[model samples]
Target: MPFASRRPRSYASPRALPSARARARHGRNGRSPVTGPDLPLAHTRLDAFEATVQATADYLQDLWPDELAALRIEVLPMPDQPPGVSGVARWRVIPQHRLVVLYRIPIERMSRLHREDDWHRRLMVESCVFRAVGELIGKDPWDLAPDRFRHW
Candidate 1:
């Protein structure tokens, strides 16, 4: 008969299949299928360096509000031109502009850390920030945060 066939037709239709865009969009759920909330987001070296610099700057600012009130902190991949006289400058301070620019590449890569670890790397970044701020304000790096290292 005309209705009879070798194989039976499937109930599901082609339209039911998810589109490529829908699949890419995670099928209405915003989160990626591969990454869940339990898994933390990737943190790159640059991100860690910037975070350390910012935290150090904030601490220094709290200690010397009046001095750093008008100052601006910035992070750049590298210096635009070679420093006038230096063995790979880690940072530059411009008192006229009240700006401190930290060179991420030189500061992170050039330093010789006796023990290479996350803590040491963070300490290195903090050192650069403190030195840069000290240079801007005509003060020694150690003097910037005196009580911090003092033990009672």
Candidate 2:
């Protein structure tokens, strides 16, 4: 069959990229660029950080495996929080990938986990859950829990 003669002309074949433009930006391998906006934003206030953690717990509870439902999602406050740290946040992640810790660190510092950021080194409640959540939604944990769920 000829290209234009097909009944349903798809934008791109399964093996092809979304479009030439996207391919140009994403590179020949067709991977899209990841950025801050791509991250999930879960917002909350400083005083409400614990609540945010609970909500994430509930969210994870809904998705929990039979063996892990009782396995509580750990939540710790970042004392002396960095200047611009998200007011309130916690992490929830799909358990399979197990890269939550790896994902939490900025990409530039991924290779050097122990090398701490001057501002963040002290005031960061690091968790594997946040990292995994970041990986799942392609955004930082702070972005995912933008606020305590009104309904939760």
Candidate 3:
């Protein structure tokens, strides 16, 4: 009679819940639960800048594969050495190592843009990449992507 009078138990486990720190370490942390890491909406300015550099480099590489095949491109927050006679270098091209190091802060912050927008920012990044690659191969930046600019 006592067993029949008692209410049925709920399905969830009675174990103690995980600590906040443990949950945070194992869970999404701060990202939205519904979204994945590949979401384009999550891109930051740095991401966009790096992407622009990569796209420009890839395009140049496709055009001049022989020249760029062994070349390596890198992005740094800032240069390690002091500014040269000209000024803070946006990029450094070392042909001996086949490496091009781009100073992201100087390139992103120092450039004078007529219109402060995403398109102009991207163009600025691309120009830096093109110039760096041009220096690497002793070619002019305009010559790097000649056909792209040609309009009939």
Candidate 4:
């Protein structure tokens, strides 16, 4: 039968939720055919991520004033990953220089509140964000590393 072998339709990547257009589309209503109140909230959390990203960028800029042009932030969506109760907001912390700092974080408060069934989604999303940034920057997020410049 023609229907027997039909493939399921694919969806837009979950990673797109953090984009500016997506954020504007979701707005305060958190209403979308593809996403619900929960997913919109995840999108909202991106505000926190963006703030942190800016802060980190500012800090780096101050320390490396000479190389500030070399340092910048780039965000990319990791859509190939799965989706559900949890999602990861990952991006690249690339610098023109060889050395750059990277940070990975999880909304632990959100995870604790998620239903048991969604634990995997939370972990998977968080892991993807962490790993994606690590891969892009050629370094992992950690506090143990020394700053590229201490003169500032």
Q: State candidate 3's TM-score.
A: 0.73
Each model's backbone clash number: 0, 15, 0, 0
Candidate 3: clashing pairs of residues: none
- Order the numbered candidates by TM-score, best leading: 1, 3, 4, 2
Residue 150 alpha-carbon offset, candidate 3, angstroms: 2.2
Candidate 1 wrong stretches, greater than 4 Å:
1-33, 82-86
Q: Superpose all Cα atoms of candidate 2 onto the true structure and report the RMSD in Å to 1 decimal.
A: 18.8
Scored by TM-score, the top model is 1
Q: Which candidate would rank higher by lDDT, 3 or 4?
A: 3
For model 3, the run of ten residues with the poorest summed lDDT: 1-10
lDDT digits (tens) for residues 1-152 of candidate 3: 01011244475859786667856876656434355656645667777776787778778888998988887888888888755666788998899988888998999999999999999998889888888889999999999888877899
Could you tell me which 10 consecutive residues in candidate 4 have the lowest summed lDDT? 1-10
What lDDT tens digits, residue by residue, belong to model 4 across residues 10-35?
66636445666655764663436566
Q: Which one wins by TM-score: 2 or 3?
A: 3
In candidate 2, residue 11 scores what lDDT? 47
Which is the winner by TM-score between candidate 1 and candidate 4?
A: 1
